[model samples]
Target: MNKKYLFIFTIVIVIFAAFFLLTKKPQQKNTDILINGKKLQVELMQTEEEKTKGLSDRKNLCSNCGLLFVYNQEGFYSFWMRKMYFDIDILWINKDRVVDITYDAKKPEVDEFESPRTIYQNKVPADKVLEVNAGWVEKNGIKVGETIVFK
Candidate 1:
């Protein structure tokens, strides 16, 4: 009787464990961006709100982390340093190729009344925009006409 009871208890425990494992949520993959053969982790800004809030009010960003803005169509998109705390390097990409690069875009001044926030835009239409820490492009040797791979 003791052996039979122990066997039943083990089977019940295994069933519960299997159920829990089947119902557990899977983790999302961390997106990696490759530019000029250098890999960097990036967060995708797919929604309008996320695109609008790109790095605003953040004190700092990780050296290898960046934000990638996604759009439905290729169009001339403008970016401004509104409420930005630090400088960034902006890359405008069309399809898989970089169309333009804005190096060391400065943060807005404390008083917008004194110094108006400057807007930056690409010369050509772009479907995506990437923002990384200032000097990241130079350090990684990223340039226009280079391919960007998302994984």
Candidate 2:
């Protein structure tokens, strides 16, 4: 009788373990980007909702951190500093090369009517856009034609 009870307990434990393993959520990996051999840890904004809210309302961004917007096709992507708290530099990428760069985009004031907001657009069609802290372009010496690699 004791042996029978031990066998049942073992079966129950194995079943629970299997169930837990099957229902467990998978962990997400970090996405890092390399531009001109310099690395930047990025948060991907793939969906329209995510891209719409890109870096807005954030008090600050890390020096080596940025938002990477991935698109389906190359387009003239326009950006505005709406609801932004800090300045940023926008890099327009076509495939793996930097096509255009918008430097030192200042944050817009709360009163849009009083302080007319500036809209920054890529000089050429681009498939991806990277928004990093202001002066990042000059500090890193990133220029058009520089290659960007995703890791």
Candidate 3:
């Protein structure tokens, strides 16, 4: 009787564990960006909701941290400083190659929150746009022709 009860307990535990695992949501994949032989930890903004909230309400960013905005096709996209506290470097990227660079985009003034926002746009169309800390482009030797490999 003891062995039979133990077997039933084990089966119950396995069933509960399987049910718990199956009910859990799938985890999202992390976006890894490698540029100029350097790997950067990035947050991907694939959906419109995520892209619209790009780096806003942030006070600072760590070194080598990036916000990657992904699009379906290469097109002209305009960005504006909404609620950022520090400056950022915006890069226009098409696939693995860099298309353009907008260095040191200034932070918006808190006093001017009700005023017109400053728009930042690149000259060419880009399938992806990368936003990093200001001066990161020059410090990391990132150039327009450099390829960014995503993993």
Best-fitting candidate, scored by lDDT: 1
What ranges in model 3 sit over 4 Å off?
A: 1-23, 114-116
Reference-based lDDT, residue 23, model 1: 96
Model 3: weakest 10-residue lDDT segment is: 108-117
| TM-score of model number 2 | 0.79
Give the per-residue lDDT of model 2 (tens digit) for 1-151.
9999999999999999999999999555348989977899998888799888888778999999999999999999888887788899999999999999999998987786233368899989999999999999899999999999898
| RMSD of model 1 against the true structure | 6.5
Candidate 3, 32-67: lDDT as tens digits: 789998888898888898898888888788897989
Model 1's lDDT to the true fold? 0.90
Q: How far out, in Å, is residue 80 in model 1?
A: 0.9
Q: Which pairs, if any, clash in model 3?
A: none
Residue pairs clashing in model 2 are none
TM-scores, all candidates, are: 0.78, 0.79, 0.81
| Collision count of model 1 | 0
For model 3, the local distance difference test gives 0.88
Which is the better candidate, 1 or 3, if ranked by TM-score?
3
